[model samples]
Target: MSTDFHGFSSGPDSAGGAPRTVVDWITVAGDQLIATIKQLVADGNVRRVILRDSSGREFLSVPLTASAVVGGITVLAAPVLAAIGVIAAMVAEVTLEVERTDVDGVNESEDGTPPPSSPDPEV
Candidate 1:
């Protein structure tokens, strides 16, 4: 079985001078996890996929690029499935961190201004 999850966070990297957002979703089923990762790669906007255990500790990080997909999506699946299998044996929830391309902060706001910034104490 599979469950739905949505997590929002940002990274320090700039995309074309704009900031990029790392969107995360957590799931338990290894197969479903693989499928989700595959789709993310197919979409092309994904920068990378971070695999994490239930404790939120990342174990595997897959960097996706246009060249990597040149062979076909199947090539990417092998490593992700193997990693997921290893992680599933040890943890229940696995987190998939999908890094999206930089978005215009002003576009996210109703007004033509950047969003207010708050210090993330945890960072």
Candidate 2:
């Protein structure tokens, strides 16, 4: 029998920009992989399944028996966990609020009069 696996990694760079995060990597992987496994089963060439991460760590393994493969709970759970993680992450974080002021808005003149609305017509 033939088996297929895929791995992925997510992280941020050192720059001050936004950080790289895997919001739904696991869920996407699980959904796609399970679909592939189902297709393989239909093709009659797959007998076992194994999923791994970028660190070469095996996250799940299962024999491709008719009943077990059809009723694989791990396959279903992976996406759920990933969804929860992503949702939690998306909801838990708050954005930084910065107040901006226009330099011209400050009344620098002694009289405190706003600058002329328009250039002097004579000038």
Candidate 3:
């Protein structure tokens, strides 16, 4: 089955930026859970990945930091991924409520689009 996606917005964060919290919701089949999560993590922008069942009960929340990615993921994610595999087998469907931030620390507008560039100096 095809997946669905939508964005949820929040205000400025500790980074002192506008719309730093952009959450995207993706619903995927239980069998596709691990693959989807791996893809998202590899993108290197995701701040956290929360998996929930059809009934909206959160099963696991994987918080991924930049360091975790740069430091080698296999060491940190192997166990967690194994657990996710088990969960995927037991559930028929799951919804991924994932948070993606600007990997470069760029700020985004309320609509989840990048902020407009500032005017050049000494025009």
Q: Highest TM-score: which candidate?
A: 3
Worst 10 residues of 2 by lDDT: 93-102
Global lDDT of model 2: 0.33
Task: Give per-residue CA lDDT, model 3, range 1-123, as digits (tens).
Answer: 767666665655636644366677777877888777766766666789899888889999988887866654563467898889999999988888888774335434556542333111112
The candidate that achieves the highest lDDT relative to the unseen native structure? 3
- Off by more than 4 A, model 1: 9-19, 74-80, 102-123
For each candidate, what is the lDDT?
0.58, 0.33, 0.69
Q: How much is 75 displaced in model 3, in angstroms?
A: 4.4
lDDT by residue (tens digit), candidate 2, 35-68: 4434433432224544444454545444444554
How much is 11 displaced in model 1, in angstroms?
8.6
Comparing 1 with 3 on lDDT, the higher-scoring candidate is 3
lDDT of 1 by residue, 7-123 (tens): 554655344666667464545455456556666666555677788766678888888776766644666766667876676666656767666555543313434222233111122
What is the overall TM-score of model 1 with all chains considered together? 0.59
Worst 10 residues of 1 by lDDT: 114-123
- Locate the minimum summed-lDDT window of 10 residues in model 3: 114-123
Q: Give RMSD (Å) of candidate 3 vs. truth.
A: 9.3
Model 3 regions more than 4 Å off: 12-19, 103-123
